[model samples]
Target: MSQPDSVTFADIEVAAKRLAGIAHHTPVITSRTINQHTGSQVFFKCKNFQRTGSFKFRGAYNALAQLRLEQQQTGAIAYSSGNHAQAVALAGQLLNIPTTIVMPEDAPTVKQAATRGYGAEVILYNRSETNREELAQTLAQQRNLTIIPPYDHPHIIAAQGTAAKELIKEVGELDLLLVCCGGGGLLSGSAIASQTLSPKCKVIGVEPERADDATRSFHSKILYSVNNPDTIADGARTPSLGKITFPLVLDYVDNMVTVSEEAIIRTMFFLWQRLKIVVEPTGVLAAAALLEGVVKAPQAKIGVVISGGNVDLKGLGHKIMNYEL
Candidate 1:
């Protein structure tokens, strides 16, 4: 198992301190009905309530905060499907550094608008024809900006580690930790923090069936890609495992699982109606995995991190009404 470079418990402890007032100490929420149905006590880390409405803010802000003075003045750029784009935009706005986001032209309009609303310049490219990495590279050369990747950097991972560290602090000794995976930043960081802080807790990553690259990669012991996903969980439509994140997940993650789009939509509806929480399809998929029996809930106390709440409401009703896997 290839682990992250010599990250000790003390490293995550330091990250928690640095991230103390910066990242929101999102609450651990529970529902009696969910607990009764699953036959397991559950603690939900509601990162949906985090700044920029996702856990990405924790890592993005942390990475930006650690940058050298020159790097801060030179500004930063990122390529994301949605949540990370908003994270970087908001981080840059607070740090007073210029930020540019290169995103798929077909990203959720709400997320794109939110990124722009933060005053970051938004660049859109065709998903099919233009490679975002190549475009970001070219832009970096021309504009001299640091490209803060969505999930593949250590500083970013350390920032993400703060969420799980806080969760363990609030609800001690969970038996299992579940997190939704797009490019694996949240899961990787959670794994590192969980292994170090709550060593006995088994960490699992959840994904939509249509965008199950992490699951495939874990099973094959090789990095995998699922470019051009057709899932409703648009936030998780990344094509592959990130370079830094892949090894971390392979080493520390206990397992990776998938849920159908139908299950995801059903869980989204349940969360909205029953939990009164507005979770995006990607965020709801971990609960959906449990609901669909893709994940056995016999592991005593299980913690699921609800990632983000950036769903598009305009066509949601129609999709949830007649959606299929």
Candidate 2:
């Protein structure tokens, strides 16, 4: 999928309309400490507070809503680590469709259970030997299920754009906006939205150092992937950029930066300790960029997308405590 010459303002508006009552119009949070420390008045679009504890729900529900009648009846299948799986599962439940999710055997138990609790049938595969895409395709072919790609579809991008629409409505205008990149759905949608809503604002993407596909793709002007990433940010661990989203990121995204695993972990804990928000590792990368000075904010305004909050408490505690162990 080549890059779209332009993802228009109307496209984003339509997406906002499609997601109007279905997806959460999540709140924008402000903190005096964040403002003082970052040296900018930060507006955090807290999708972590969104249903399914991730912004993935917005895109998933929107994509599901746009599916043809036949596709809906046929049901949908997806492969995801956690948040996206749960989002698709919940969306399928709400739309009264059968959902099947292929997750790695090593995926966080909390996330796996949450997806199942949403009424989707969960299939576990060996992360090391099986390719998730191949598994998803096999299932789709066998079950006659429509594949709802995690972040590659236009409908998904449109749906994700609504978060920016809501943010701009609440924060007026921003000089710079930061979003964490996984498969580039949220980042691509954010670029489209920021371009439309605040034309002068620069949209940047943050990624974990271990899964810096977006950053590499931006510099190489080609798509990149990590076959098997080793990071705690499971949501941002897509092996490659989508054919559609890669071009979108290359063309529209102003900059892409990476943060260290330690930085990501520190930022996650900072939000938990200071902002009193429980965010997943991927969700914390934007804040990590700010805290680590990966990209200094432009003075006008700053908006950061806090993507998800579905961390396993016991596991997270273990990670934090056992860092040196």
Candidate 3:
């Protein structure tokens, strides 16, 4: 199938088939404690159990798998703060394609090590000083590598939708579906899937208060970008949504909400303590919104996408032990 700028529910279905047997059908988890606290029935789509420890693997693998044989032979390139880097690297290794990733120098050490451990050449740059996209493009051209962006492409969006598709399939139907938004890929994709599979579901995107470009854009109906925001949710520190994802979000997403950094940390701790799941900060965006009652639909059936589990264990432990954000 030829790639398009925008993705559809059919495209997401095709991606699901393509990923069959390759990607894990991650579990849908529930916490009675959480339900009691929020006064809602919540199902958590645990993408943290996904390969490469994040939902990013779904998109990365799908994109790379569709490349021309010649392109695969040449290699693939990507830029990410952490999870996407590891996703692309692991996908390339599985497909016997050389992969190169550009990551911020100050990215979580565990993520950096995991990306390199997946057999990809890791290039670190100062995020504040260098533009990662431009650097990745230059390297891709020089090395004849195909660029598989983190969340800007059709394949990525479609593949990411499979998470919600699986969630809805497992849980029947939901009144609301909450997703963590970074570049809007997962939110857009999930919106499309929910529109098809559960038309009554109101899709909501959640982000850190610091990285509220998506929230602003959703409200204003105009795309906006923000510089690097200092938030503990490193996975969601994206500057803005991409061209491909923006329109889908605007049309299909019902609402957008922002959670404070403290709310995010508190949610993460709750997940670890009550749910027995170690979700990263970004993964807790949706849960934070629900727990904080930022967007309330009392007694509603809700689905929350736990995006990833790539936490820096030592750092997270320290923060939790000391009640630090």
What TM-score number comes out for model 1? 0.95
Q: Candidate 3's error at 205, in angstroms? A: 0.2
For candidate 2, write residues 237-322 as lDDT tens digits. 89888888888888789999999988898888889998888888889899899978888874548999999999888777766664
Summing lDDT over every window of 10 consecutive residues in candidate 2, give the lowest-scoring window.
1-10
**Stretches of model 1 off by over 4 angstroms after superposition:** 1-8
Report the number of the highest-lDDT candidate. 3
Model 3, span 185-242: residue lDDT tens: 9999999999999999999999999999999999998999999888889999999999
Of 1 and 3, the candidate ahead on TM-score is 3
Angstrom error of the Cα, residue 51, model 3: value is 0.6
Off by over 4 Å in 2: 1-7, 321-325
Worst 10 residues of 1 by lDDT: 1-10
List model 1 lDDT by residue over 1-325, tens digit each.
4455534456567777877777788878899988888889988888899999988898888888888899999999999988999999999998898999999998888899999999899999998999899999999989999999998888787778777888888989889888888888888888888997788999989998999999999989989998789898988888888878888888889999998888898888888888899899988877887767788867489888899899879856666666664
> What residue pairs are clashing in model 3?
none
